[model samples]
Target: MRPRVLMVGSAPEERGGIGTVTTLLLRHGSRHADIRMVVTHREGPAAMRLRLWLSGTARVAAALVRGQVDVVHAHVSERGSVVRKGLLVLLAKAFRVPVVLHCHGAEFADWYRGLPGAVRRGIAWTFRRADLLVVLGSSWRNRYVELLGVLGDRVVAFGNPIELPASVAKPAGLKVVFLGRFGDRKGSAAVLRAVAGLPVELVMAGDGEVAATRALARELGVPAEIRDWLSFEERDELLASAHVFVLPSRDEGLPMALLEAMGHGLVPVVSPVGSIGDVVQDGENGLLVPPADAAAIRQALASLLADDGMRARLAKAARSTVEPFAIESYLDELAARWRSLTG
Candidate 1:
């Protein structure tokens, strides 16, 4: 029988990168493993989340009592997420089910280091108890080792994966796209400062500080297409037509947006945060800029706008870079790891 896996994280219905990642993993991972999921958290009022925590713990305990779960895959961030999932990890250990802690938070290093020494040590103890820790990129793997003092062998990095479209024909017009929350963390404000007067049409998709972001664009007298949210088809159409994908996030954990953009063959102009620098090499697969730098962002966008040949070269290379991260390969690797852990 296939090993029974329980994935604990944000509800798939939640509207954020973590939700998107969980949805993709379940969709693609089911083909290779017997995976089940429970919601430890969801997007809503704080009161709702509190109820979920109580109910989620009950459900996990029930599953453990029935011996239906062989592995527990807990996705976690810092602060409350860490504390909650740390309890789940200890619970899973008590039940003799191996736990896989998938670290997805972008600001984890800063958050952990800022904690009081006692709290930091407590967090580290929880981390050290996990059977395996999955990170989005090698940089994060190093961070976990250095921060928690966990063995390097137990922490592994796997890029987020997605099912690829058969083909993406270049669409007409110069379209620049940004697919993420609209705030400083995503560097939406910086992107606005950079492309305020650019010739290309800037399409900002995703919600957060919508009113403020729109006001800034108007204040700068730049025409932009700001959509609160895009359906899957709309997102696909936008990426296919886009010539450049920009994300100058102050922090990120291998953003799904950048990977998706690269898969769609849009040359990425991104910050060197998280594991982004692992895939996007300046002047190679894509361009990398310092986080939250408007001038640098402007220069990168300007260069891509003026040189069609350069864009095409980077686009081709960017598309190739995502091949290894294809959903099938990701599933294979995950299944292999699960098998080893269970055996």
Candidate 2:
């Protein structure tokens, strides 16, 4: 019999990596396991967020009481997410259900360190209670075990999944696309600064500090086309037409946007932070630059724009690199993990 897995996280409509992951798992994971999602958070005012958390808590408690759950898999980030998902983990443990805590916060270590010592201990205790902890890559697994005192064996490295595109033809023009939140953390302003006076069309899309990004672009005299959050079809359309994908983030946890861009055969110019270094080999599949460094970003982008053959070679290699991260394979592995715990 298939084990019933209760997957809890942000709402699918929410914009960000966690929302994207939740939507994909719900859409494609049913074949491998009987999974249902409970949204404990969304993007909105504080009062609305509190109501959703309360309601989600009630639903999880009721499911536990009725013996409807075999496992509770909670997706968590830093700050408030740690507190919200920790409650669900404790509740699941009280009901004797195995719990899987999937950590996706890019700035989790820095955030945890800034907390008061007593609060940090409480958070560590909550994390140690989980039967399993899932992270984006091996480095993250090591950090969790060393920093949070989670058992090394209990943490698993699972990369984010993407649907590999079919035979994407190389784009001919010098068009650059950046898909991520537009803020200092994502280095949106730096992208504009780097591409200023360059002979390329720049398209930047995503939420957060959009107005500030636009202002910076105008100040730098960069003719950038800034858009709001995009739907799946819209995002793919942009990727299909773009020759290069750039994300110069200061921090990340194996960004879904980077993988999807590479899967679509776009040569990437990204920063070597978090698990990105594990996936992108500098000068091989893609080019890696230091975060927030406009000079390096410009140099990389200029080189890609100047040489057609190099771009094509890198684009082909980039697509091949991300093939193993397909959603189908990810679901199969996830199902096996759930089965192991239930058995």
Alpha carbon lDDT of each predicted model: 0.89, 0.91
Q: Which ten residues in a row have the lowest lDDT in candidate 2?
A: 164-173
| lDDT, model 1 | 0.89
Clashing pairs in 1: none
**Model 1, 1-343: lDDT tens per residue?**
4789999988986766678778888988877788999998977899999999989988999999999998999999888999999999999999889999999998899999899999999999999999999999999999999999999999999978866767867976678899888998999988889988788889998988989999999999879888887766788888888889999998999988888889999999999889999999999988988887899999998998788899889999999999888888988998888888999
Candidate 1 matches the true fold with a TM-score of: 0.97
Candidate 2: Cα lDDT at 265: 91
Candidate 2 local lDDT, residue 98: 98
Model 2 lDDT tens row, 1-343: 6889999989987888888888888999888778989989988999999999999999999999999999999999999999999999999999999999999999999999999999999999999999999999887888899889999989999989888777797555789999999998989888998999889999999999999888888888899999999999999899988888899999999999999999999889999888898899999999999998899999998998788899989999999999989999988888899999999
